[model samples]
Target: MLRRLLVSLVVFLVVGAIGSYGLMRNALATPICYFDSVDEVSVIGQTGHIHIGTLDNVNAWVGTYLIDLDFETAYDVYDGRYEGYCIEDIYSPDNEGGYALYDAEGSSANYEAAAYLFNQYASSVSSNAERAGLQLAIWEAVFDYGSYNLTQGNGNFYVYNGYLSSAITYANTYLNSLNLFNPDTFNASGYGLVSDDNPLSLDPQCYQDYIIANPIPEPSTMILLSSLAIGLFGVFGIRKRLLRG
Candidate 1:
């Protein structure tokens, strides 16, 4: 009878451990929270697409509705000072098209906020940063294209497809120039730096998830999970023997 009880406990524990592990895996697969606006701004979405935009404080806001990267609410990368923020134009041909580089003017004390963002980007040895830098280069390229358009006084709007194609190539050149990423190995899957070299094709969420998920798991959670799994297995073994008896 004692052996039977032990078996039953063990079986129960094994099932529980399996269940818990499954749960953890599922949770890890899905994001806890996507992007959201911090300010009381109305998000306007593009027809037949996931893109979103808001007019309020649009100049300073940095986020995307489709591949949500709300700098205001999520990371507060622009709380005090302004280095730069990722932005998309609602009126542009593609929501993913167009980007900017902004720096706050004024005293040094108020600019650390921007510094924080730069540091975050500059310090990271991650592939995402390499891709992000590519996107930044693309943005610069597009901006230059627009400036040319303006200089020529062409009232027609600029499309992004050609620029996007060229931007990827341009970015690769820049990446090669810096020798931060491999020219031949760069792909756009957001897997690692060189694996995804196409900067324009990068999904913002993919980049964000890479940043959020790849961080080392907390020691406390690891300990808890290990303990739980061990306890569960022990109980399961006990339960199996109990049932046999």
Candidate 2:
């Protein structure tokens, strides 16, 4: 009876190990692909205000802003005023009755706020190259925020709002704590695209293309591997016991 039990245990463990290994192998072999050939120009030129369904949609809006505002002014305004507003305040259903950005009936307060800030600081920018660099940085930050929110949940306004608030707090604290905005200490490329041109034109689909190129590792791969290891260990231990018996 002892030998029979050991044999059965070993068989069960072997089967489980095989199953887990198969799953892991399958997961490893199949790579998930996202938007690869998305046209950057089309993405940037999109003027129709709509809900952000994907990173592409967000990119389209960003592209529009890039075209509309000078890079330096856009950067200063976004960096300064982004913290003052929340995604919830910008897109909340309550504001749908009034003026809103993406909603049907409301006015686009978010764009207006950014524009106001840009106009306020536009005169301060001296160099076109510097402005372009700053614009890229702002775009990258916005893209990062939009991408993160999308991952939390597709079209989840609450998640996006909370994330936006937290991101602003974190960025402001980090920038202020170190007083790191000086040109000598700052690395603008780390933030976004840098260019020598007066107005930087970004491919509308660049963000989505980037996402497709860099696929995050699936969490399930680790779980499957762990299960496989446990199963193999169990099988090995049971076989050893059987041999002793």
lDDT per residue as tens, model 2, 50-77: 2232332232121112111111221122
lDDT per residue, candidate 1, 1-245, as tens digits? Answer: 66675566567656766665456434422332222322222222111111122222222212212222233323224322111223223332122322211111111211222222233343342343344443333232223322222111222212233223333343445423332322233321111110011232223422211111111233234545666677768777876876887
| Candidate 2 Cα errors over 4 Å, as ranges | 1-202, 206-244
Among the numbered candidates, top lDDT falls to 1
TM-score to native of every candidate shown: 0.23, 0.20
Error of 1 at 77 (Å): 17
Worst 10 residues of 1 by lDDT: 188-197
Candidate 2's displacement at residue 71, Å, is: 36
How many residue pairs clash in model 2?
Answer: 7
